[model samples]
Target: MKPIKNVCVVGLGTLGTQIAIQAAAYGYNVDAYDPKPDAFATMQTKVKAAMQMTRKGPTFPMALWDAHAAKVRLHSSLAAALLTADLVVEVVPEDVESKRKVFAELDRLAPIDALLATNSSSIPISRIESVTTRPEKCLNIHFYQPAVGMNMADIMGGSKTSPETLQAARVFVRSLGCVPLMVQKETLGFCFNSIWRAVKRQSLYMWDGGFVDFRDIDRAWMTFTGMTYGPFFLMDLVGLDIIYAIENIYFESSQDPRDAPPASLKQKIARGELGVKAGIGFYKYPDPECTREGFLLGA
Candidate 1:
């Protein structure tokens, strides 16, 4: 098996920075690329905020994040980023067309032998691999925010993804001190994310239908799960804009009206209430209601 030494992450948005930092912390040469000039800096702030909110997610000290992060070389162009990459993780917008464009660029620029993967939360790699020449080398290697201590990766192979490519990705994920949750077959929102998606969907429906206040739902979740946050809180961390987009993908796929994301959720996005990144969403950030005393105790 060819060991992966260099990791390149495309689109340093919500998940990219954490992924990059984790790879670098584990001794991999990491590079990141994002079209937005200030994307990396913005992501850094979000990560720091996440690190503060989390205790068990981050594997290293907050002080060490900068050192590990500094190890990543940021590039202005995709070609430069993929030049030395052995594995490329694409974290672009979760739309199929948007992903197609990125995979095409990645296929054209990345070294022929390098493996290409997408960190898309819901869409599977099968919808993307056709855009690349090396379909066998393409797979879905999804990650949650590892920088905050969720150190598991969802690993799934596309229709044509080779056994070798899938095996190599498993090795790479393990090297980062992560549990690689293998998907035996193609599935949207693979593994834990699929479970998370179900929670998000039901939560949004209830809120939109006026069945219950979002906070009450969150309180119940935290109360039962013993987690620091609930479904709505986690969605904010994922970004409301991203949540809306992923929901749309589900609606478009199933053509089920019931599967549609709530209209109010779209309004929130339209108003720029894009969760933690925007400082507001289901709750205000850095000091959301979920964190207040007596929130879970129903005060």
Candidate 2:
């Protein structure tokens, strides 16, 4: 396995920021890229808030927060970000054309030895690899949001991805103190996400079909699974817009009417009730019921 020192993260959104912060906190030099100047303007503040939130879990050293934050360099261009990267984790928007465009650029500008990975939750690495010359080096490295707390990433490869690349990715993830959940074959949504998609699909169905209240669904889930949050809560945390897009990917993959995202979800998106970011979704946030242990546990 190659010794990874410099990690390049392409995107500055939620998952991207988490990945970038975790990499830096682990002493790796991280270069992050985003097209928006506004995104860059508040990068430090976002990182600080993320770090503070994650610090609750004692995930990263608080004493090193500033130093680690400093290790991350934000770039406006892909070429600049990929310059010295040993591993490139692309967390760009989850669209086929968008991901393909980033891969094409990465394949052209990044070092030949740099391993390429995507933080995509739904799209398979094979689809994205078609745009790159180095299919063997491209793989998926999907991370749960608040990655530092989760400490898990799903590593999968395309049809052409070599065993060597998979192992290298596993080593890289381990180096960051995160567990690597390997996808044995090319599977949509990898491992945990596949299961998560089911829960989300059903939750949306229940809510849209008028079968159950979203809060009740979460209550049953938390009580049965012993998890702090349920599908609706997770969907809100992930943002309804993102959830809709992922559902669309699943729908496109299966073409099953059941896999189709609920129309209510689209309506929510239209109204700007995009979950926690919008301060309203399945539940009101900034103080969602799911966040309260007493509410979740019925205490």
Q: Tens digit of lDDT per residue, candidate 2, span 1-299?
A: 57789999998876787788788887888998898755643644544543342233326665665666667898878799899988999988889899999899999999898999999989899998989999999999998864326678899999899899899889888877888999998888899899888888888899999998788898999789876667787787677999999999999988999999999899999999987667788878566766665776454
lDDT of 1 at 182: 94
- Backbone clash pairs for candidate 1 read 57-148, 57-149, 58-149
Each model's TM-score, in the order given? 0.97, 0.92
TM-score of model 1 (CA atoms): 0.97
Q: Give Cα-based local distance difference scores for all models.
A: 0.88, 0.82
Worst 10 residues of 2 by lDDT: 49-58
Off by over 4 Å in 1: 54-56
Shift of residue 110 alpha carbon in model 2, Å: 0.6
Q: Write the per-residue lDDT of candidate 1 for residues 1-299, one digit (tens) a residue.
A: 45689889999988898899899999999988999978988889887886665434577666788888889899999999999888999998888899999999999999988899999988899998998999999999988888877888999999999999999989888888889999999877888888888999999999999999999999899889888888898888889999998988888889999989999999999999999889898888788878878888877
RMSD value for candidate 2: 2.4
The TM-score obtained by model 2 is 0.92
After TM-score superposition, the amount by which residue 152's alpha carbon in candidate 1 deviates from its true location, in angstroms, is: 0.8
